[model samples]
Target chain A: MADASPIETHAHVLTLAEPLPLDSGRALAPVEIAYQTYGRLNAAKDNAIIVCHALTGDQHLASPHPKTGKPGWWSRVVGPNRPIDTNRFFVICSNVIGSCMGSSGPSSMADDGAPFAMRFPVITIRDMVRAQVALIDHLGIDRLHGIVGGSMGGMQALSWAANFPERCGAVLVLASAPRQSAQNIAFHEVGRQAIMADPEWKGGDYYTADLDDPRKVGPEAGLAVARMAAHITYLSEQGLTQKFGRRLQDRDAKTFGFDADFQVESYLRYQGLAFTDRFDANSYLYITRAMDYFDLAEEHGGRLANAFAGLKTRMCLVSFDTDWLYPTSESRAVAHAVNAAGAPVSFVELSAPFGHDSFLLDVPALDRVIEGFL
Target chain B: MADASPIETHAHVLTLAEPLPLDSGRALAPVEIAYQTYGRLNAAKDNAIIVCHALTGDQHLASPHPKTGKPGWWSRVVGPNRPIDTNRFFVICSNVIGSCMGSSGPSSMADDGAPFAMRFPVITIRDMVRAQVALIDHLGIDRLHGIVGGSMGGMQALSWAANFPERCGAVLVLASAPRQSAQNIAFHEVGRQAIMADPEWKGGDYYTADLDDPRKVGPEAGLAVARMAAHITYLSEQGLTQKFGRRLQDRDAKTFGFDADFQVESYLRYQGLAFTDRFDANSYLYITRAMDYFDLAEEHGGRLANAFAGLKTRMCLVSFDTDWLYPTSESRAVAHAVNAAGAPVSFVELSAPFGHDSFLLDVPALDRVIEGFL
Candidate 1:
């Protein structure tokens, strides 16, 4: 089922010929970026749109995930006749660096022929965009028609616009902030601690044996705990109440035990466990660390407006009212900065109950907004 | 320092002669409650005020904690010249059941002289209130004074007003909800899972040997992770930003590794690690479970007002504007219920940056409100 694609999609892996320079003054070589392309590149190669994937997302934009057998995360927005309109714009979604999804990440084999694990140089959102730029260059597209994303993906889109403003005609960011907040870093810190605390983690070297071996599984418990903590941040309290409330899970009464008695608990446990199967614990640590270090304003002259200075790319920023993770205020700040920089930017705060995850959900208003922007 | 009290404080343990029944239909014999009294009871015993403590809080309200040598949690509110005015009203603070602080919790010994651990009966907010009632009965205090608390402590105060309407003259609930929201349950569940995930947890039987042994420590790592996750919920995003907005922790640059690079991360790590020193992992699980099971309206015919019907006790509710844990809306709901029940009720949402922890902080407005109500 995962092999099925609604449209003709091509997956490609490109190895960089030169070492990728990192913010930590380190360099990574043999950098392999795996990406998927949907629709045809026009004769002029001017209709290409680069789609950045968020944390935990990968290169499966309009097809079923080969591992999870689930439909592409953005199939609702990026397919043919969808908001992204693959028929009109060539779509490209890549597995970000420092991710485990067929990219150069912690789980990828290094020069030593062992998994990079903790040895993988931490990559920032800008570094992810840099890799995407390499892919775009390899495809012979000098400048993209548009660059679009949400959440961490939006961070990449913003980074692209800031770092290489002339490379894209337009930028669309949704439910993302210019920098990680203290609370955001705190939550990510908890997840990292949970993963590192597990004895099974073995200093991120648990990949020595096959993870399928029951006795030698890699920090699944810790990773699941981490995921559970994070999953809560991705949702609104009202959303959780409307979905689960105080409802019991397959029982009319409390079990008087430590089982998942409440429906919310059951849902969280399932989400946590499901996440462990798809994600690498070490990769989780590295990616979250990357996000924690992201500060676009700091990268400039201590002013966010400096990041968007003299930017010609038309920008559209969308925020969800219920997104407490990256709240509407965050987007407003960015919009204000973009405005201060004299950039052509459109911003809107749409009402959604899904919180930070509203960007990925079935938001009709978001669909209309994206269509209008693109 | 812990043994030193500003006022002569007496600690007492009351053993209930009969078994105390629980919401889970289970009962425990020899139910022991540990409590501390500040100031002297008047001739009529009508000047005694029950001051309940929140989760992770204990009986030493106006004294130093025996374990950490820290000042009493609510010392500002319960001291001789404080808002609670210990000189005017005898203040009593008790260790709630299911807590590790000298209470009959998961860490307490059973009839067989073994730690109850997972065998401890799953209790509720109502059960905690029930135990408090027994303690009050033993103290020869009946139908007198007032009941006041904050956070989970506030839950006990509300439970008192509902279950024992005539037990107190007035009820003051601060920063709490009548029922645990789904988001609340989800966070608690994450903490529980983190504790259970530790290999050292050993199915809550890690107390087989001396926990002080460096080679054989009890689930401290898991408990710390759990604490880290929970500590975030107790704070507001604005408060975090104001206190530690991406400030480097005693460093000029990030190490680009899994270390506490930010001041907030350092603070959280210190908090999480320090918590494990005094808290029992299994006790943490049971207490949180109790909180998750709290639902006053569900217990009273599915209407919050039903719980307060025919109540004669005066009610004063306080909520912090930034407290997302039990937001102002929750207190508003309780206030509306009290109003519908034709009870005298006063509700106020104070502007505080501390979030849920505002109840325990030095809020001048809260001090004034408490003084005026008393």
Candidate 2:
């Protein structure tokens, strides 16, 4: 069955130069939408579901990545017979505006034929959802049977339900929040600084420069630091302890010298180095900003419920107990807001030691939740 | 009242050149100890309470540091009218053998008159405590009223109870564990590797070299990464969220450039740079190894209880709810071990948002607990 199912899906893009009105009264223009679709849309297009990827994630939700040879991040939960089954529903995933995966991001060429780099406008979670909405309109789909995501994806899903309630039939939000908390924002900031501090970064225009410039774009050291920081948030402390507890890497006794002496150290290095290959540093900076700017309530006059005022989607929110990133309280807050908005909502906190990334891992209970919800 | 009851503290050193038998069947010697004492010894010298400092801390427990203007780390809990009142009990804090603060560490001169650096013997927590025992012998203190410490300090306190149960009348451990978990060790390894990877380090001999050799010692970048990694472990996700959230550093939008745009970025930079000023990169390498080698139970045939067999010390173990570093489970394990050994033990998991550093902060409840116990 796996062999029968092709891993590559067709993708398309649309560009616009008109200014987009932002929540902060700023306008974004000349935007480009990069997206992919799986399965065929029926005549009514009622079987359509939109999947939003998290921070650092791109489109290609059900396909093998061209550069990394890894399967699409959500393949486990979005394939045939899995939750959000493609057999019954047509799925659409889009490369967010600030992303580098063929999307209009820092690497995209400006009117002057130069990479946007530091010139790209800061985007918000709502802005990302707006771009998705434009793509749906371009695809001629008036309504989605469901909108699903986790972490940053979860943020987009909630944004769709709250921003265009009538357009979404159901929303599945896993391990997300209504706004970026102070600590969450702090961690992302640390990553950004780490990348910027690298002398090779060269501002953000390493693409046009000698590529070896560390201060602008090619700051591999800083990027590695950022990746290491983010990787820690993806796993629970218990998970980390269980997987790599004080185990030395190559030597029995510490050489009393600076070396990779523990398994966790090696793992973090791999994570950092591997991440740089697939991700663009500038995109990291922009996407993290979008996440940091996300505040559903703040956009709707300080009442989260007001943001979802008149939403008509069936919402299922899932949280992982060990996910310190967007803990159970954040999920509960969303559930409360949805309930207060008089929308249909279901919320559950699952026991998973994988932290915020449990949704992407092999958690049978999470699978069950997604299966039942879908 | 704080100034009037000033204690006379003196810094002294003890060196042993002969081989000292270890549980691991190894003998290490020419070991040196740097320590300080506060207050006066009672008629029987039973009022001596050894205060062990955490990683990067030194012998200046209650007195002012000569190098840095900062007072001793545990001054709040160890001064007059404090929980472990210096007026009533003689307090002694020692710079662990593997550390840099005037102890026999990697930076100390060897027989060849050069900084030991990587040549320093791989030391363990037990070895550190053993050196303390020699110091006690030198001071003619047959028994101590208590042994107090937090984090790594707590490790030494636990070691005291395990290796010389008859020497301590009471033992108070704060924010510590019996052994380093794999995850904890992994962080230290990363730091070590970072230092080693630096071009300026000059293979631990940077101190003697006139040229800018990255390998000799000044792996500032790597050390910074290590500090950043360790700093995260010292904090709870909630604390991070509360402290920095998604706030941008100096702008309202993502720079799309490689810069410290987020407040968290600036915070981490401050944390990393500040750490290097007060710490030695080489000492970080050795001390972390000592922590990783610490296994109280393994020293007693895999039975943690046996490590503290026949102990007469009154034990108090304090844990913070948000501390993933040495979580409550670790403290509970120690309490269970002490209980099995028939020692009088008190265990409490205090509610605090500061994570592992809660013990150092002004948690009134913690003060009350210590005050009541002492």
Candidate 3:
């Protein structure tokens, strides 16, 4: 999964001419947004569909990743004849600001020529959407046909609808929540604590000139641990049971030691280690913090419906039955809020064992729902 | 929770004359078992009831903690007139091997007078029960009363019932499984990685002469992170939502940096840090590994029912509805296995929002169930 070749695409980076204001009451100068575009914008520029990536996702929506060579996280959902069909609609996915991908993040060089690291201003879901809006404005597109996202990407779509309701006509939110729950925040905190606990983290400034040696390239161990913890939440318990179920890893019996005795442990270790190679630890902390701070209802007079008051955008929310991370109840709550707001909304809870990741996995029902919504 | 005076109890340590055999094919020499006994032993000693503690628990039982002044973890259900009724039964709670309490564990001294640490042999649930059995032998108790436990303690109880069915008449297991699930092992692996990642851990030899300064004591940061991760799994998502929700941690708004902005984060941070003061990192690793290696059915021909085949001990199992850790299904599965073995068994799924910790929490229904079962 980590050693895929990069597929070429029309990836571009747009530098903001002015400083970008932040929710933290700070402004970031020289903000840059990296994005990839699939298909062509119509003559009227109204067939554009903005696809937001989830946490750890990048701009390679329909192409292979530049580093891992693996297919884009949502490659199955957005392709030539797929649900978001590049043949009919223009698809645009941009790397969020607080990410390690080719965007303005902790790993990016600052005004002083050093990596921003912890110096980078903490960003929010709305800030990410704002950056995408800048990219849209630069493309000379006044309005988009739709905005689609899953997980953190879904958060961006919801933020866009709440903050810039007129910029897009429709939105499809998949396996996401309107706000982060207390348990979700606790999980994010564990990841952050894991990352920060590593001595190699060096207070989030582990990037060095001696990059030739991979061992010296940041807190890989801590980042891997964080990834392993987070990965468990992405997949359902039933899914793990079906996939690994105390099965011995390449052995007939238990090792009776600290080594990975179960197949699940071996798989988690691999996933954790592989993640550190393509992602930055600081970016993980910042992105998770942003996600944890997301509370649409709290930001809008303590009523979730108020966030969608007088909204006109068409909304389609989809959730998987097995996703404990952002369970179907979360999506149902958002749908009820949208319904209360008198918005044209559709909600469906699809049966899938993959949990929060079912939106990206081979769930045929999700494809039909996205295609119907788009 | 970390600062409380000790309420003295008759805590005793029994050193085994012979080496104790382990599941890992290694034998531990000079093994010492620390235990606390409550109530009086009748002349026949048939009223003796052994109570096993869970993963992070000690032998405090119905007494106040020595490290923290807080009441014993199960003080709510193990007092004089409480369920398990000390007035009627001689209750014994022993610190399990591989635990950091007064027992022989990673923190215990080796033959060379240094802390065992990583040099300590890996142990298992059955190994722990074997140690407890040694202590029971020293006390001259044979074929006496019953065994009761919750979580890891419950595993010990099951192990005792299986390995020495003739020694005990009954066993009460609460919120535990016949084996550690794949998801549970994955969680334990994350915690181990977090601990091993800390530079201060110094490969498990962090013990220094300067014990005066707690900062240089050990890998407190890493251990805390591990505790934080495990703490999240102890409670139900609904329990967390009800306890903390999206509430801010003594602040009106998020700091937008890496601080604990949410109440849950703050609570978890406190829990993680507080744990470091009372627990050993290496002990945590060993205990969790022991738990991950637990599979009752695998020990007996890959059939759960075979684990209890021809068992004569009366068994009662209790599970909490909201406990995703070891949910009601786990208890049901164990009960099924016991029933299939033609043993006397009873199972109940109690309604409790505290999750896996319902056994330890103030659940009135749980109290009634325990009282009736005993």
Candidate 4:
């Protein structure tokens, strides 16, 4: 590990020299995809595995978060002898097109060398997959052993088999649905409104680190509120109750004011605040919009099965029992669609205390499913 | 009826000549309780039924809302031929203290003739019940036939029996728990944070309706955001899906920007916007804090059964199966404790699509239960 290059543990950015076609009737040029790889790709390149990330995730799958100095968000599932087993597979996790990591997003430089910000075209899961395809091509990888993801990442993984069936031989999806529900869209909408309502956002022109003028700064408060709201959806009510349980924060009695009286409130506030340091608000807007627009069935004209028509890829769908975000029924729908398309698919509904976040947690059952499926 | 006096049809405010003691160890002088009554109280005065309203609800239980011109929030289960038939019962509903309706709240004039704003003392459910008791005393009622309510109203109903067991003969608590859970407190905290974070909130001092300076006024945006978040919890995922599942809002295609692309988003936005017209942000903060502090067991020396100790009040508890906010299990716990305390209590969990608000909606099963219970 010490002999490995600094680049090995950090992000690997691929500048797509070609224009990327988007689902929103627009073209994005000079695109960059930020990715990180663990374990070496075999000479045949057949051992290469790509990992798609969720809404606010980046490419630091098994390394430390560059900004927060915290462990990687998915460090539990993608290291040596772990579920994905970096020792046996070359795992790659890339920050999606509309994300803030090193990827080409709203915060990235435009053709005129200025941040695109709100001017950036809205992207879709398909568009995100296309960029990742270009990255794989640039790396001279003809095909990958597998593609894995949970939540929004599952959308990308599913899209990969539809668009590039031969690129990835296997697909493993966790805690995902075929598309976003009305409740899903509604929650995301609240987050977007929260960001847009902030005066500091300045019509998404708050990317500049303007210390001179506070109004020109980024929409931290709005972004934090957005995160706080979304954070509530990621966990189960039972989990939150078990963890915090109306317990006061460092007090035996209530403060009777607008303070974080409960521990859960303090936890959510901290989640919102810490998120502002590492993510861009505009990017949050764009990526969530992309997710809201995601409907595999609609893309194939109300036929989700048509997306995987006669697919040869081996796929496994996994859902968490506690994941209200994308309940087991959602995964079952995906499995039915893929199975109807004549693809080899296996489905499992695992039990976990965490909700949508079970895929990233220490769920031994999920680890076994992934290990077996891979 | 058309022959009824305007005072009977509308709200009547009673300025308490005596100081009202609160659970927060503070006394409120010149306390006002705005109440509405339907039908006449019998000579025995035992037929007087006190109906408690939830947070954001007022005394207009079966009448049209003053601002929205919409039917009363719980009109489906009230009125002449309804569950709690007005032909027999002298139904009375008072706007809870710490609420913005005609009651004495943060928006109401303090002793100094200025709004209390954030200076208002923190209130609890017991505090609300105490105010109601004073109102009942003013009306010359000794004993009530029943105390009925849903959600926060249910909290008040339960508190009435616990605090003044001999004052009421029967208690009907619908879709409510004896206390707030961590998830409940967490959701509330998000709303409070949203309101406080808005610079326009000005530490809850944004009560001025200044036409010259709009920004110096109330925290509309923050309050709207709070409502949007809270509104989601009021409906079930299945219901939201059935009502507005992936349906676009007056558009042929996605706008590719931050707009209400989905009907659910539009619906939520409308709910948030319309809520700002009638609700005060400071009252929302105070009431939510009171709700969070509600723990019957904690107040009864860490045993819920103690709240109903040797209770003579016949109680009926009903829960909506779809209500994740206050699930059926919560009601079951209450029933168990009351039964253990030798109180004649009936418990039923009814199926409803609307989640926590099912008690307010047109559910025939609930109507029957209410009718039979009373």
Which candidate wins on TM-score? 1
Distance from true position, residue A224, model 2, in Å? 2.6
Question: Using DockQ as the measure, what is the rank order of every candidate, best first?
Answer: 1, 3, 4, 2
Q: Pick the candidate with the highest DockQ.
A: 1
Question: Mind giving the per-residue lDDT tens digits that candidate 3 earns over A198-258?
Answer: 8788998898855445664788888898899999999999999999998999999887677
Model 3 chain A lowest lDDT segment of ten = A1-10
- Give the runs in model 2 whose Cα sits over 4 Å from its true position: A1-4, A17-30, A208-217, A242-262, B1-4, B13-32, B189-217, B237-268, B371-374
Docking class of 4: medium
> What level of docking quality does candidate 2 show?
acceptable
RMSD vs true structure, all candidates: 2.6, 3.8, 3.2, 2.8
DockQ of each two-chain model? 0.89, 0.39, 0.84, 0.80
Candidate order, TM-score descending = 1, 3, 4, 2
Which 10 consecutive positions of candidate 3 chain B have the poorest summed lDDT? B1-10
- The alpha-carbon deviation from the true structure for residue A258 of candidate 1, after best TM-score superposition, in angstroms, is 1.1
DockQ of 3: 0.84
- Predictions in order: lDDT: 0.90, 0.80, 0.88, 0.87
Query: What value does the lDDT take at residue A2 in candidate 3?
Result: 18
Candidate 3 lDDT, B1-374, residue by residue in tens: 11232323477888899999999899997698989988878888788899999999999997878888887888777767777777778889999999888899987888997888788999999999999888878888997588999999999999988888878878999999999999999998899988888887888888765444556477888899899999999999999999999888888888888888788989999999899989989999999999998999988888989888767979999999999999888999999999999999999999989988889988888888778877
Worst 10 residues of 2 chain A by lDDT: A208-217
